[model samples]
Target chain A: MLDIRQTVEKPRMREKISEFRVGDTVKVSLKIKEIIKEERNKKKGSKEKVTEKEKIYPFQGIVIKRKGGGIRETFTVRKESHGIGVERIFPLHSPIISEIHVLKKGNVKRAKLYYLRDGKKR
Target chain B: MIGLIGKKVGMTQIFSEEGKVIPVTVIKAGPCKVVQKKTKAKDGYDAIQLGFGEVKESRASKPCIGHFKKIGLKPMEILEEIRIEDLSKFKECDEIKVDIFSNSKFVNVQGITKGKGFMGVMKRWGFKGMPASHGTHRKHRHPGSIGQHTDPGRVFKGKKMGGKTGNEKITVKKLSVAGIDLEKNILLVKGSVPGSRGSALFIFSDLNVPVNLQTTQLQAENKPVSVEK
Candidate 1:
């Protein structure tokens, strides 16, 4: 299994990624593309020119679960947005992820913190 | 159609330009050497015999070594014949690489699936077994109600009973080419291909018939003709 994984994922693996474990509060800077529509005057009629603008959206949350291995590894981050809990799963090696900054490391016993979803306000 | 012999490396996910994750199977294809070319006049069809994977001369059989020696190449472990409409583009001893599929969008991968041995009706034939409850004793995974009562007599011959599961030639059609690495001679195809890692696979451009000859013909037609006096 290790031999197969090395051959398949080694070529596409991300070179530099900050090492952060589960139960760590991290800020993930994600690159999002927004399509901006503008009216352009052409030869006969007006046409809409849709252009894409790239922006970085920072999401700060606590890492609840880290699953998979190698290039297919993914981590789930849970955060409270406007008193509502929001969970987002992001591939660790995805090119869309601009940067990952570890804010705080919480010492936890279990690998998956799925109990936090049902427990009372932490 | 032109094709190359490859080995199934493994499966991994890669992000597309749209940032969507696509599951892909990595295939270590070619550097295949054309060992023989069959023409319509000689063999009743046009095809190219390609050889891949180097093997030690001592380890290979005498006939296999002689076949490679005739083409002026090292001993190859696997050999496959690909039927194409035109065989003039390829020549004996010419090396075919992964770049042959650079212009191709989709391909059909043929390989032997993993063997599951003798499986039950529920697993092999996808038969809905008997209910676990309602006093159903030890016949839970049995193939309930095979045929009719006295009219047909015995069970029908062509029944979908479980026997052999896999380990047969399976062709997966129209798998999109996710990416290609020329330097490493690797091809990343979208979705899972047949067989496990290191299994030999025949990767072709089309499933039914070879159409790569059309591209060569179009290139010939587009060539600038010299003006003569």
Candidate 2:
């Protein structure tokens, strides 16, 4: 039988996320909207209207986990910034993601690198 | 009020126009026919009964076949009556499509939740069990102290204990309507509804109903667009 759910979802899922797995280093580019309130003077005088602008925000990290299936899929990316570990989960088919760049492929035995959160082995 | 008989398809996350992720539950709603109408003068109330799904004539009972024949409509699998404030807007045998909610922003969904067979207190009532340490001794996940000492003597009535869970009618009100596919009769609701996949659902539109002012204020602050209490 034809599934109406699949038909409705097919058109929205236009992004084909790159094949990257746990321990692989990648970069994700997201289109973010920011509101810019312009000031007319050096003081708190604002004559100009607030403007909404879109910009590409990039994050480079190692893929730690990939969860879910199909267009509803999400993956976790972890990176070290100034000796602090930062993790972010991105939806695979989200329209906000502009590009996914795979930098290096990694060979690991586990699908999820959650053990890396405990302590730095390297 | 405008409503339809529908079935839950499944749940999925979709992207909003603002580049935000929204979890939605897809529903396949009615193109049902108004099988009968009960007028105020004759029946002492105004109600329109709708028929959903198709069934073979041989599979239906004699009375059901006659009921469909009276309205000149084909046999439908389920018949449900919806009480309404006005009956003049609709006629018997009139088809109610999924587009009835095109102008409506929200809807109330009602369905029978999936049944969990004979669950324990931990899973059913969300009761905190005894401590794992300190000589608890095989008393994990047990509901302690049903009643007080000899003063009360008996367990109080309607205590929060485990019993049959789910499989009961639940209504989730003021769920935002994300999108509607009129051609396929599919409705995309912005949040979760009752029941598992493939369960029967009643979708009541918020066309004439007044919007809750409190929720409209919350929506202005960019909170979740729901008023389900």
Candidate closest to the true structure, highest lDDT: 1
C-alpha TM-scores of all predictions:
0.84, 0.81
Off by over 4 Å in 1: A1-11, A37-49, B133-137, B149-157, B207-229
Per-residue lDDT of B208-229 in model 2, one digit per residue for the tens? 5434645645755989876576
Compute the lDDT for candidate 1: 0.87
CAPRI classification of candidate 1? acceptable
lDDT of model 2 at position B104: 84
Best by TM-score: 1
Q: Which pairs of residues have clashing backbones in candidate 1?
A: B1-B210
Evaluate model 1: give its TM-score: 0.84
Score candidate 2 by DockQ.
0.35
The candidate maximizing DockQ is 1
- Indicate the worst ten consecutive residues by lDDT in candidate 1 chain B: B207-216
How far is each candidate from the true structure, as Cα RMSD in Å?
Answer: 6.0, 7.4
Prediction 2 TM-score vs. true: 0.81
